[model samples]
Target: MRLILASTSPYRRELLARLDLPFETLSPQVDETAIPGEAPPETARRLAAAKAAAVARREPDAWVIGSDQVAELDGAALGKPGGREAAVGQLSAMSARAVRFATAVTLQRDEERFHALDSTLVRFRPLSLEEISRYVDAEKPFDCAGSFKSEGLGIALFDAIESRDPTALIGLPLIAVAGLLRKAGFALP
Candidate 1:
């Protein structure tokens, strides 16, 4: 079966590659703005489906994978920091706190769909301003939600993480993705 990933994120692409499947990648190019008052998990689910649907419209025969993640602190969503100052601020606010990361994934083929949502709790250790700055300077996680990369130096800032799938924190959940693909009739060991 023809397969496609409805996003251009390198992280997602890398995670999918671990499945050892031949697939094509496309930019979903959908607006990612969260609906006002929408919960974090809802935002993730909506965006993931939107991304898959957007690409499925173009390639009706191919199964497309779409995924999105939203980091929630105090009930509000945290977005990609986008710059140094914002990264620093986000890390500071999250210091000594437990943040929830809601990640959603969708598999779409025409009108048919399968979905999964993974929730991860990241407990950030109490951090000093100096530590935040040093980490931000070292990792510059400007493109990641929650202002850190769990796969990289950002792991140092966390006291603990609780998740069914560790890959969810990196932007894709492999276990969920594998299950969705298998349900969609793809072969996996």
Candidate 2:
């Protein structure tokens, strides 16, 4: 079966590649905007489905995988920082706090659909302004929600990570992805 990833994120691309499956990627070009009343998990779900549908429209015969991640702190959704100061602030606000990352994925082909949601809780260690500054300057994770990359230097900022699927924290839940793909008749050993 043909496989396609409906995203341009290098992180997601790398995570998907771990399956050792030949796949192609297309820029979903999805607007990552949250609705005023939508819950963080819901927003992730909506966006993931939208991404898959967008690409599925172009290649109806291919199995399209779409995924989205949203970070939630104290009941509010946190978006990508987009810059240095914003990243620092985000980290500061999250210091010694447990942040929830909702990663949602959807697989679509013709009329068949499969979906998965994984919520990972990351407890951040107490951080000083200097440490936050140093980390931000070194990693520059402005493009990631919650301003930290779990797979890289950002892991130093976390006291604990609680999740059924560790890869979900990085942006794609491979466990869930594998299950959904298997359900769709894709072979994996």
Candidate 3:
């Protein structure tokens, strides 16, 4: 069976490559606006499933993988910064605070589906304005939800990280993905 990834994120694509699986990527053109009253985890799960289903509609025979991530701080969801100023602001606000990154993954083929949600708690070390500015300028993590990339220089900004799967922070949960693929009869080992 052909494997497809319903996303345009390079980070997720890179992670999936680690599994040594040959997968094609398609951009899932789904609206990502958060629904009112929807929790962070729910948002991630809903988007992930929507992405997979969108691609599954196009390629019904292929196994499609979709994933989404949301960074939550004080009950509010933080999306991609999109700019250096916004990234600096996000990092400043996240300074000395605990943010929960909820990453959800969905795999679908025909009428069958599998889902997994991984939550990672990242405690930001106390950051000064200069530090935030420098980091933002250096890494330019404008496309990342938390305004940082744990796999890169962003690790220096964290005080502690708590998660069952460390890859979740980078955007995909390989452990969960492996289990789901195994259930779907993929030779993961």
Candidate 4:
């Protein structure tokens, strides 16, 4: 069976590449707006499933993988900040607080499906106003959830991280994803 990744995120793409399995990437265009009364984790799961189903329809015989990440603090969703100002504001709002990043991954082929959600707790260090501004100015992580890229300088902003799968924080949850892929008949070296 062929392998497909239904996302265009560079971080997810890079993480998926670590399995050393050849796969194709496609952008699944699904409405990402959260349903009213849906929790953050459920929203991530729904979006991931929607994305996989959207791409799976295009390749009925291929194995498709879909994933999504949602960051929330105090029940408020923190989406991608479009620019520097928004990124700064997001960081400011999250400073010295605990934020949750829920990452969901799904694998599907034919009529079979497997899914998992990895929620990571990230605690940010108490950040000064100047420090937040400088970090946002230097990193420019406007497209990242929580307005910070843990793989980069953004690590300096977090005091601790609690997660079942570290890769989830990076956006893919590769351990769980790899297991799902194996179950779907993909061999990993």
Q: Lowest summed lDDT over 10 consecutive residues: which window, candidate 4?
A: 180-189
True lDDT of residue 11, candidate 2: 96
State TM-scores per candidate.
0.99, 0.98, 0.99, 0.97
In candidate 2, what are the lDDT values of residues 1-189, reduced to their tens digit?
999999999999999999998999998888888999899999999999999999999999999999999999988999999999999999999999999999999999987899999999999999999999999999999999999898999999999999999999999999999999999998987
Model 4 lDDT vs. the true structure? 0.91
Clashing pairs in 1: none
Q: How close is candidate 4 to the true structure, as a TM-score?
A: 0.97
Q: State the displacement of the C-alpha of residue 11, model 1, in Å, after optimal TM-score superposition.
A: 0.7
User: How big is the positional error of residue 136 in model 3, measured in Å on the Cα after superposition?
Assistant: 0.4
User: Which model is ahead, 1 or 2, in terms of TM-score?
Assistant: 1
TM-score of model 2 (CA atoms) = 0.98
What digit string (tens of lDDT, one per residue) describes model 3 on residues 18-54? 9999999999999999999899999999999999999
Query: For each candidate, what is the lDDT?
Result: 0.97, 0.95, 0.96, 0.91
Whole-model lDDT for model 2 versus the true structure? 0.95
The sequence of per-residue lDDT tens digits that candidate 1 reaches over residues 1-189 is 999999989999999999999999999999999999999999999999999999999999999999999999999999999999999999999999999999999999999999999999999999999999999999999999999999999999999999999999999999999999999999999
What is the lDDT for 111 in model 4? 73
Residue-level lDDT tens digits of model 4 in 1-189: 689999999999999999999999999888999988888999999999999999999899888999999999999778899898888888888888999999999998867899989999999999988999999889899889889989999999999999989889989999999899888778875
